[model samples]
Target chain A: MFGLETGFGEFFTNYQYPVMIIIGLTLIYLGIAKKMEPLLLVPIGLGVILVNLPWPGEGLMAYEVLNSSTGLLETIPYQDYVQPPYNMAGGEPVGLMSRIFHYGLSWEIMPPLIFLGLGALTDFGPVIANPKTLLLGAGAQFGVYFAMIVAFGLGAAGLGWFDFQMGEAASIGIIGGADGPTTIFVTNRLAPTILGATAVAAYSYMALVPIIQPPIIKLFTSKKQRQIYMKPQLRAVSNREKIIFPLMATIIIILLVPASAPLVGSFMLGNLLLVSGVTDRLSITAGGGFMNVLTILLGVAVGAQMSGFIFLQQKTLGIFALGLVAFMAATAFGVILAQIMNLFSKTKINPMIGAAGVSAVPMASRVVQRMGQKENPRNFLLMHAMGPNIAGVIGTAVAAGVFISMIG
Target chain B: MAEEIIEAPMVGKIIEVMAKVGEKIAEGDVVCTLESMKMENPLVSPIDGTVKEIKVAAGDTVQAGAEIAVIE
Candidate 1:
């Protein structure tokens, strides 16, 4: 009775905003129920739940919530209905989760750790297979640059909504590269302030690749082009060639764009285990335990920031919308570029492989294989797409390098 | 007179030669096979061409974009 008033205890005991709780719960539902990138979304839902509850651990519990948004779900633990600071004589406040949101997300330790995890999980196999696909990856980066200009224009036009300095805008714009890691890397360096928004934009867009890319691809490819029968070429890459690839890549990419070394290094290291053939144990470990752990950690770390305050901005919405556009533009751009190459070359490129030009790696390649089968069931586009799929990875890395050198 | 020459897309050992020097073919006809990535890829002719030469026999590794045959 003396220590805990029912109202104060009530505010401290439960979620203040039922809608927000449901939103957090909704993420969990999507992650688990619908299976939309569950590896990331599940942890995010848990983080959302943790950050929203009324507790000292939430950082901003010191503030009073007379009529805040979270007050909607204020749970009561005691028998006494002693009202809050407004109604009672001198009761404590109801801003527990608000405080947590302030400290946990806005403070900036989480997103970078997420990046570290993203770095640890990545593989450079696709990039290594087709080094020339790097250019297509770079070409796809046109979305980043284009988005930056748009961000800058919006900033000047009074939509100064995002804390987006030119550097921050550039970082945010990298979502167009269809590269989550690079966006994290760039934003973490240039515009640390917008880390949460940028991360959300990247992950969300990545999850939507299948939906976003197909429409864009269909728009660019006609029935004839889609049905064009390009006989598959078998690539006989030697163990020696595969082993030497990571080393040659490290040398060339590092020399050409030193800034990419960190991401390129770790990514290639993961792939090296896979291709070296001498370390089955190591390959399995990297591809399994190491990869899974990083993915889980990355999801949680990213979700750690999506609490109510910062995520509610109009710019956040803008980033999501623009990221979608960028993804499409990149896919289409890669396909058209490949089509142009087809015009000049004796050998025809399966335009379906062009869709893999975005650096989502095996995911994009898998998408290509599925679509290629849809058009022609006998056509196995996975390995062929792997050439450009991996190329896209290198391309994105090189683009990241160019961005970092100019702006880092 | 043949106007086409087929080439390798990657460096690999020619595990099998399916076509002969005078074989007439259509587009995407398997002219030779290169074993790479542990799969035998039919070095298909890009167009209707006569196999002018069997450049390499079994156990030969050719570089990427190397000419495997010519057709005209």
Candidate 2:
């Protein structure tokens, strides 16, 4: 019998494999035990582990190369693969995860599809009821540009510590929007190489919105500001208004930023399906099973991209640091804007609702609700915060469109 | 006594009903927890009163403006 040798020795040869595996396991634990973004994190964690594991044959992310001499296909590590149109003819992507990443992300199919699902699930009533909240959402985008300037400045300073191009800076800056799909959409277009880092940072920070947003909300606003209460009920929005919102928004946004058509169009289409009261079946599927499948594919593909060699780098650290700065700055700007708005408005607005402008959806709004409750139990700011919460989505999508138009 | 009806703030599932019929509750007291958009939102009482009627039970799906409970 032939002696079968286990590939255990590969761990010693490449220490990064073990380190990456541990990181993968930590993400899994956080997802399952802590219940933190389990839908995305679980698949991402598993993908990381799968790609980093020792394999005697071609790896999960291996690229296929056609060997002319032997007239056969040969597999090479993804990092070693060269861009197409320059490399030898007949070469193709062969790995399962690699193909998904290429088709779903590189071809720019997943993000828009994900937005469709999100749109079906979202209710634009809050934003329609309170139009001024749109400005608050726009205010949160200050962090995106602020971080971009800092990142560009650092890179231009000639400091060897960091080097980022305009596209890369834009990709990193979108992390401030606190919208996961937007970050992925922007990064996949602007800097595919940093997609894994930016996606992970965006999702992780989004999950940590409850923790990340409060300090900044409290730091800028005093107890009195935090306790400022608005009317408990907003003027009831009619279905007619709800139906008109998506159509008008799509037309207006697409006109302003043509590049945003894909993201905005898909989002509005989903919203139309939900509100039209005529596409129940399509709405259910878009927001349900279809979205789930896309999410799994997206999560795993993103995770597979985080190979030890690509993810374990000095640049990855810089991306994470810049992402944090983006989130903090976005929160601060939102709060400051609300405070400024109060100077002119008659009805008082809880400054904390401005923090929800980062578009973490219900999470950021929930943080505002909790902090509002802490300040005064009588304050029910969830619905009010939701105004800006939903607006953040549109705001981020517009910011992404601007980036793509200017730099993409 | 004036009757005050608590309405579901948003569309969601009634995860848990914390208030009982005829139970004395204070204004702002959480009467039930509504799970909407994957977030647990507590439906609080609008005025200090006794719970006159519980209109919905746990696991019931609700729509925005649906009456949740009637307090007197």
Candidate 3:
């Protein structure tokens, strides 16, 4: 009686749900077969499937009402649950992913925690040894600004593609960062509605970094520039220098960009644990258990945001299209700027390394290494590429801080 | 005189040992290199001395402040 009405009857009303389920299956297929960030895509794909299933409005993935004063999650009244604008804020969550998103993501705790783990795992020595790579990282952020301006312009022109507000533009722009945690953090704050599309786009593009970066790198650099060799030996950093670097960087960067304090603070704390050498247990925990748990929660929450009605939009398609351009633009800008730097500097760097400045971590750097080796077997650019690769991570966080400072 | 021991400066794997037992080395010489988070950190001698013992070998994981070598 109640079951068929909720299942078959409800399914007939919105044909989009079935289609979304197919899309979810496609994500699962791609994750399993293509190995495209399976850790994230698998959970996200399952989340999509779970949320899209036909159920009563107050069922599992739907927003259940909460009493603010009593601090209890309550069932939403049938009328309110079925009405438009189902996402009422300022309530405790009953659903698992909702609670995770509300407490972890909305409160801005999970992303920084993820960054802490990343910091604990990251090697900053390459960036320290080659300071100039920081500029390449900064240059790669041109795509973020470029994408924002373009998004805002399209919205202003009323082109039917999208009409993004300032916050929405900022959220969309961060897809260029190619850093998943930072993108989600920024989107959660700026435009929660588009969080699913933006996160999916960001992660999807990040997974495709090897596919996305090489063409842009080739477009920007000549074969000679790609094959240019720089010595791989890095000056050994001392323990004192390593210990001092994170502290100094956090202090100086936060002073300059106060808004980045949360992200940079957590990141530096993780780095401190690693470099201080006195906190092996804490470092291992941060890098291993903590990161894994947070990644799962974050992935599921992001996928849960892809509820059928929210994700099936022309604007969603636009976000995906623009995301690709943003990633390519970031990669191109980094390579082109590296070529420009070569004109003024005595020691020329392999321009292939510049494409690694997109914060996709070792993937972007590995692409550079592979491409370099393909050109010349003697070339080992992984460490060299890592400098800019790691620099891109910091640069993206700094950009997010700047955006939050100006727009939030 | 106080006995001296070279301690690991950070948590990492001992990738290479730069000093050998019974070898005389000056202050600031690298005793061993530790690889952590994909970057190499060099453990240095605080005082000039002959290496008395090598406490850790290549491929061994070490904790920060753990004794890696002894010099006297």
Candidate 4:
């Protein structure tokens, strides 16, 4: 008879397990009550609890093997777990979440698909109207390189607190990109072991963009600078220009960085679907129900990766701290670059819009809009900020490609 | 009196209609709030006048340059 042991023993023995469950509950509470990235956080929080639950047999992340001697199913080491296509005759059972993670994330399918959805949903008109803002977006990537250097310094040969290899350092630094799918895509390739921590850090910081960016924006800009008004009317982008943008961008970016082809290619294809006008049905499906389904799966799979054994480490704390640094540095660089641009340009730009270059999409731009209104009620920075906001997405993706090519 | 057409500045769904036909409004008064890219953008009247026509209703998705209202 297969006996089920009460989870109480394991809960008491491994303190980390219960702690992780509490963290999971906290995330759920934040998602529901506080409404912070609820779509992704809620699923991830539930996944954390599910994976942490104590089971008498192989756990949610374990492999079940048939014990010929005892005529019972027994848990096998993760290293020895069988890959997909289990033989039912042999009674091999794979952990459900583990299988999802392997197929969705480990197989490198989900992130690109998510990018396709995001691309389809995005509007590049703002960037098209103000091409110079692309420079601000590229400037924000300085945070990635800055954090990578810091990570390398922390893991120096002798004084290293954590033994981070080249791939691990690159993965950790990409969290500064503040783009979740990009972080996941790069981390999965370079350092799968730290994917859970890096992904969580990326999403959490992104949700906190409103809180995180303002202080840095204020630190870098004066009241006068924040109040600088941009003309409300951007030159209307023609339909022909919109249609050509994605195609042109894909060719240029891929030609420059071949490693970025997967992410950039998927993103441009999605955008092409949206702007082509003739592909309205395909665009709608790509950005609608199909995207929603992937979001849920990606959220759950990422959450499931937060097992206590893998997540509750000193290095995990380091990743979080460094992620904050990356975000702050990215914001600072964007603002500084804008101030520099103003010194030479005829038309003045609100330095605050540069903070939108952090690639959190509408959230970062929203922060700029809010701050701008506070300074000058007539000031509408939303459309103007969006220029760099969308550009940041491309900037982060390109940076991820750079990292992959160099180290991955 | 010159008639002014108020166009939606961006593609989005009209979440709220703040002005009605025959209602007097100021140039900067918000005529409708458009939700685009998950951000709420208030579309304001360009010229102070009576709302001559309301071309959109709540939940109506409007494209950029679509006529939202007419003021005179």
Between candidates 3 and 4, name the one with more favorable DockQ: 4
Error of 3 at A254 (Å): 1.2
Candidate 4's residue-wise lDDT over B1-72, tens digit each?
999887766678999999989999987788888887788877777678999999999999997678989999
Question: B1-72, model 1: which lDDT tens digit per residue?
Answer: 538767675556898887788877777677777775555555667677777777888788887667777765
Best by TM-score: 2
Instruction: Mark the regions of model 1 whose C-alpha exceeds 4 Å error after superposition.
Output: A1-19, A60-132, A160-163, B1-72
What residue pairs clash in candidate 4, if any at all? Answer: none
Segments in model 2 whose C-alpha atoms lie over 4 Å from true places = A1-6, A54-58, A65-74, A82-91, B1-8, B11-35, B42-72
Q: DockQ-based ranking, best first?
A: 2, 4, 1, 3
C-alpha-based local distance difference test score of model 2: 0.88
**Model 3 residue A217 lDDT score:** 92
Top lDDT model: 2
lDDT for position B57 in model 4? 97
Worst 10 residues of 2 chain A by lDDT: A82-91
- Consecutive 10-residue window with the lowest summed lDDT within model 4 chain B: B37-46
lDDT of 4 by residue, A118-186 (tens): 999998999999999999998898988898888877888634346677788888788887999999999
Classified by CAPRI criteria, candidate 3 counts as: incorrect
Residues B1-72 of candidate 3 have per-residue lDDT tens digits of 556887664467999998999999887687887775465556667677888999999999996557999888
The i-RMS of candidate 3 is: 11.4
lDDT of 1 by residue, A95-186 (tens): 44333333433343333333333433444444445555555556666666777777767776766454356776677667877776677677
What do the candidate models score in CA lDDT, each in turn? 0.63, 0.88, 0.82, 0.85
| Top-scoring candidate (DockQ) | 2
Q: How high is the lDDT of residue A119 in model 3? A: 91
Model-by-model DockQ, in order: 0.08, 0.34, 0.03, 0.22
Q: Write the per-residue lDDT of candidate 3 for residues A232-326, one digit (tens) a residue.
A: 46667688888888999899989999988889888989999998999989999999999999989988778777877778879998899888888
Candidate 4 residue A89 C-alpha distance from true site, Å: 26
